[model samples]
Target chain A: MTTSIHTLDTPVAVVDVARMNRNIQRMQQRADSLGVRLRPHVKTTKCAQVVEAQIQAGAQGVTVSTLKEAQAFFTQGVTDILYAVAMAPNKLAHALDLRRAGCALIIVTDSVAGARAIVEFGRAHDERFEVFIEIDSDHHRSGVRSDDPLLGDIAKMIHEGGAVLKGVMTHAGESYKLNTLEALQEIAELERSECVKAAEAIRAAGIPCPEVSVGSTPTALSAVHLEGVTELRAGVYVFFDLVMHNVGVCALDDLALSVLTTVIGHQPDKGWIITDSGWMAMSRDRGTQAQQCDFGYGLVCDSNGTLIDGLLLRSANQEHGVASFEEGMSVDVEKLYPIGTQLRVLPNHACATGAQYPAYEALQPNGEMAHWSRVNGW
Target chain B: MTTSIHTLDTPVAVVDVARMNRNIQRMQQRADSLGVRLRPHVKTTKCAQVVEAQIQAGAQGVTVSTLKEAQAFFTQGVTDILYAVAMAPNKLAHALDLRRAGCALIIVTDSVAGARAIVEFGRAHDERFEVFIEIDSDHHRSGVRSDDPLLGDIAKMIHEGGAVLKGVMTHAGESYKLNTLEALQEIAELERSECVKAAEAIRAAGIPCPEVSVGSTPTALSAVHLEGVTELRAGVYVFFDLVMHNVGVCALDDLALSVLTTVIGHQPDKGWIITDSGWMAMSRDRGTQAQQCDFGYGLVCDSNGTLIDGLLLRSANQEHGVASFEEGMSVDVEKLYPIGTQLRVLPNHACATGAQYPAYEALQPNGEMAHWSRVNGW
Candidate 1:
């Protein structure tokens, strides 16, 4: 007999397949409507089945955060992979290995020194690498400024040093802080424009810059247009979380990932329902903490995926999540959620939560469950 | 030619073997002097090699937060195991399986309902399972109050139903908030006396309560005496982190764990030296945020493991960490920390950071490295 989600062990990662498919379709349609290639970042799920589904639903290529991800995806027959993070000289050999093994692996750099290292490594190995110069959009994190002269110099370093200057890419990660569509649209425009400007500067400097990629979950869903962008990339949309919910990108029902936990005990005087799933299962990502509605840990839901009103996973230890009622709703917690009672918790950030588990219990609409293995660690 | 710490891939967990050995010896000596058995919680570093060292250093039994840890340690010949987390009835079968395999797996429960389920499951399986009654020493997390009448009833339920009533246990997890020796000792004594009171209550009810266990990293180190406590348990002391440092327990040099990362790029305008280790590598555990000094994500250290004064990992994305000067200290960003420069980051919480990697590169005193595989996922 096949095991259902209810039969699986507690503190396990569960993926609602129906909701996941709907989310996948929504983002694919959004990217299609915006007229750009959708290269979903596999760093979010890192699951072969999920990536295969995205590819089947029209994701052009995959974006990875590590060489391990690139190697894993490449081994799974995915040839087009972009190692999104700036290439450290130490990892050049590993990236070269993936490329030599017939994978179209692209590397990224935002500094002249980084570009020089990639070029020197490629020259030493007799391999010309496809490289992308990262542009700093909204000053969120890594990347060269769009108007900075370093951008053209880095682009030239790659092209002139016998490496392919593939394009310019930037993630509007700051968009995660916005709660309104107007703000998200404004940042999305900024991300697209800045990245495109960098690409144009590279071209003006006699380097061939083909692609302009930009996205983040909120921006990918809220952007009015993608004028100069060639590809849209987003990760958390596949498993929309409470952070995305508070960001006005998706509703609570759109969340596909939840930690399946069992109520192991209770703290009656404090109105706490202690759960088996804690930071170890849901992750320590308080991504929703600074958002409009801070979900302390996560939003509580019933075993069948129904939201439990006023219930929240307030605090967590390593293996124990202390869930309690929000402020004044004082019901007999033990009578309501007793020992052995199974509950589901919607995570604040899907990518972080997913990384905690080795596999996902994909709950199908027909009550069947499939085990989907995820690639964790660097 | 042996592999050195510098040769390991970026964003890898590195364990200073010498520091770890010193930590192990210190905790073992503390337990010895306090006249209590040391049951070091293997949840901090779930590596068999680390656990082996702890056992060799005089730790009697292992304390685990998950049944997976028990199974793993048991497979490695550690039969004396205490599954410290409150027992969930759904996991009774797994516990039974371990017992049937000749493993002395001790389980815990804090409620009558939980006791009844454990006894019933044991009766059905023809096994008298050893159990410990969890006591709420400081209103920290899960447990029955020490003076609560329900405690005796739960202990009596297990004894009357033909299950082995092992003893009483408590963890003064709130001790983590204490920075002064007096505060730590007070909480530690409170933990000891309260857990002993619960054991006395159980015995007063005619149930042979044998064991009295209590601990926390801070309490374990600061307790002048463990008076009525038979055994002590602590986890993070094995690989002390920034939170423990801020709590005034371990010195900066006592930190046995650090995430070895490479400087990938830089945001010179913001004086941010970007590294490959982010929340994904160091974990989103801002455990030190509420402590004496908030070490943003972690304290920055040089490649040789010496603290770099005033430099901190200020913010983190999924795969990128922004390391910047704390306040007044300023240096030429590009000139000081160039691309490809390796840096070691001390995590805010060792348990959380250690969980991010599947294996650790143990840095030997002789400048060699050994791979220690960690068991992750429940």
Candidate 2:
């Protein structure tokens, strides 16, 4: 049966295949121009098809937030996988299993304790693991400061423990907060200079620091250059969200993922259109709340992906989304969007929202929808 | 091999089986004393094991927020299912299919448009689906007002269309905002009073409205009496959380669900012990942000589930959680919680946090962990 967005079940994740392809090509081309290998983060989609597309578009490898992603992608034939999150000592056995299974899995760490654990585990397993020294470019999350003297100590531990200090990496996650082009450009520059500086210092200590990787969706797209950086890692770019749009990286039309919902009822006096795509489908990620343009849950669009005038999901419960006018327009909401009307809501975050769905209904340009399984959880 | 919390992977969901049983028993007893049937909303845990415990503890049936929940639970041998969300017309076919499959699935609706669609579908399919009219008790979310004329009109449509107008149901969701016992009790009464009023109006309009359902975790626990209410539905009570704690219903110790995470690294100077449980695991609920006490992400507890004084998950990224002191104490983070230390974090909202995990590691009283699969998606 031919299925349009309206024909699909409510609260289903829909991916615009054409827009996704365009996003992939844009990111890949930018990486190519900057003379760096794009190891696209698979955390956003966590789908085999999306990662496959990225690799086909010239991505050198895959960056994963969880070991599950690395295992899932590696099992799907993508050998070079970087486990980007700071490794816990307890997870060493699992990481070793993946490495021993012939997956080129690169583990990252910032603290001396973290490095020692990785080194100790590598020695115990009789395996030489490639380790990346995490750098704090934005101080937004975990990482060692680029110029911190402890970097030498950590580098020495990795090397002495029979492991390779492969490189230095940092994610300019705070770049999502920047709306102005100048601010984004500055953050991008800082991301590059700091990460490269971290790598140079590690090499100066006589430790071989081969790669310097840096990226976040905003920083990667906004960075005019990627000097001295060997690899770039950016997720969410494959499916730009309202957060990215508010950050001035992508336009509303560039959003490739949305939650397909059906209007069940309405609050006539309140001008509200109640939808099945609540926080469970749209996610509780209010990533756009603090941005220049706050999309309450998401920006409402017709089933065809056309932006509906002034409508937005004002609030959400577990399984009910209250869509109303952004400006509190007193127009009859039920008359405008009657019961059973299918609407596609552009989520505030592709990563958070996409995590809520079991699979994505990838809509092709030919008006066909394909189910792409998206792996979730740790 | 037998599993304990210590042996499990980091960032896993854990359910304290003992505490859950206690919670289930308490709610079932409350319903018994109040002269109502306890229909536990399986939407909270979405685990057959958890639902089984509730049923074993004397729950009448199951209340679900999604049709998928009805279908899954029905397959699990739960015949009586109440799909509580306002039904969209397109979902009528799916609901009918489930009904024909020998599942006593009751669909709820509020508007005339919703009632008419259900009627037309019922007449066409030759299936008389049981319908519940949603009542707006506290004006929190979806429901027809108790005094509204449309309630009678919708009731007329359901009865005349050859479908049974089963009853009226309302969720005092706003009761979660109340910290005072008096406020909670009043809201509970209002929920019961308003729902009863709607039921009476329906009966007066020549329709037999047999059931009167009303509940919220807080209201269900605090209501002095559920007078004129035949049934109660509460989900999160099965696995209480910080939001429930702040509402004065469940104590902090009653939070059965917690995210089992391992400390991966530390930002010593900043007094931060980073864990693998971030927004992806803890979820971006922040439900406690406006509450009396804000437990950022969650309340941190030791591996044994003992509350760690002053420690809380301060902020979270996609894959990392920065656990710091609630009072911003300049304590030695590394010494307090070294790398690889497993901690169980009590979530702000149980429903939101539990949705992130694929399964729960149910902690038995004898200190063993059992893997309980949790179904997700609509």
Candidate 1 lDDT by residue in tens digits, B125-180: 89999999999999999999988989988988999999999999999999988899
lDDT of 2 at A215: 95
The docking category that best describes candidate 1 is high
| Alpha-carbon RMSD of each model | 1.0, 1.1
Residue-level lDDT tens digits of model 1 in A336-375: 9999999999999999999998999999878789999988
Expressed as tens digits, the lDDT of each residue in A237-286 for candidate 2 is: 99999999988889899999999999988888777889998999999999
DockQ, each predicted model? 0.89, 0.86
Candidate 2: the clashing residue pairs are none
* Model 2 bad stretches (over 4 Å): none
Mark the regions of model 1 whose C-alpha exceeds 4 Å error after superposition. none
lDDT, model 2, position B364: 92
lDDT of 2: 0.91
